[model samples]
Target: MRPRKLDQPRSWPFIVGAWFLRPALVMTTKRDWIDGLNIPATGGCVLVMNHLSHVDPLTAAVFTHDHGRLPRYLAKSGLFRNRFLGIFLRAAGQIPVERASASAAGAYAAAVEAVNAGECIVIYPEGTITRDPGLWPMTGKSGAARIALETGCPVVPIGQWGAQELLAPYAKRPDLFPRKTVSIKVGDPVDLSDLADEPQDAEVLAVATGRIMDAITTIVEELRGETAPPERFDLKKARARNGRPLEDER
Candidate 1:
């Protein structure tokens, strides 16, 4: 499929990134981008997707860029540790998030600001790669919902597969030859209008997050042509089932 013409202005960081990364992606993987125009052409929005592989973000970025937007990801703070890489990331408009800490709130605030500024915020609601044995999306966190409610921006759900073929989750090496296909299906904006004016309570956020995940899972079901487990994978529950203690207690 032809890429949507890039009419939006891009900064030097984006230009440089595309110059370096896009070519490699193009050469190594075939894209099966479905309904990419579902991503807003202009305005602040949150694009939430199920996390599949470590390298999925590159595919996600290319998918977003192909449809005419630079994806500003809420990346882990650890990624910004390198002095030069940090500078490049900051220049590229990526937000550094301290995962699993009070400081993560800072990233939430930064995301809200980016959304308000009309930037496209790419968030993996699962936060990390899936642990489901079948690679179905695990239960998600509520960060994406909070940002959407705070900014009243559209929340678009994406279902992706095949990145694992290129680089399986937590795998050190990638299989680049033979060219894996990265397929992503973009769903319509999740219907959170009823909850738009509701108070930002835990229950409200969960309901919104569930809707977002459900929408994404539906699309993933479409892509995989199978049924996902009735209950999404829960890390703590899995650990308990295996007689393993939670991380903090260990």
Candidate 2:
């Protein structure tokens, strides 16, 4: 669908990516995009979604692009390691995040600026693929909340599923025999007005993050038609377990 209006010039890199990726995705997968209109047609906003597979971003990009807004992601720094790919990503206006390092904070500043500049900033609050046994959204990081609270932009929660079917988390191979349905549902903007001006401390951030995760998880449940575990997965505990129990992180 063509955007009703273009708030920003479609950058060359974005155009190139769309030209190459959109058609490939169309052929390789079936799309089930719901409520994409929730994504602001032309405004600065924070778009948060669950992370399930490396392919998640690509499918999400297609979803967002078709909805009339280009997604500028908080992509991991490792994707920028390759010289050619790094140049393309930089030209595409993607932000790099050195997760778990002090430098990771830089992405927050960049994301806030992007949101303020009338661009949609897509973030996977999980920071990485979920370690949850059921592949439900796990605990979230504060980056999305920090950006939303800082800019006071609309925090849009998008629930994603089915990408992992195309390429399971951390799996080296993709299963492409039967076209997978990439289901994406956009939920209402998470309301933070009550705590908008409150002190931006750990407690406040945690609350905001919880609301964001809850919104996303609720949508994911709707998409999957399954209930998420009562307690969200704690990745820190998984790390302490030396990442054992494999897929059954329960």
- Taking the tens digit of each residue's C-alpha lDDT, what string does model 1 give over 126-151? 87788899999888889999999999
lDDT of 2 by residue, 1-250 (tens): 5434445678888889778988888877998888988888777999999999988899998788888787899988888999999998898899999865688778778888888888899999987888798999999989889888889899999998999999999898988758899999999999998888899999999999999999999999999999999999988777768955332321
Candidate 1 ranges beyond 4 A from true positions:
240-250
- After superposing candidate 2, which stretches have Cα over 4 Å from the reference? 1-7, 243-250
Cα error, residue 106 of model 2, in Å, equals: 2.1
Q: TM-scores of all models?
A: 0.94, 0.93
Q: What 10-residue stretch in candidate 2 is worst by lDDT?
A: 241-250
For model 2, the local distance difference test gives 0.88
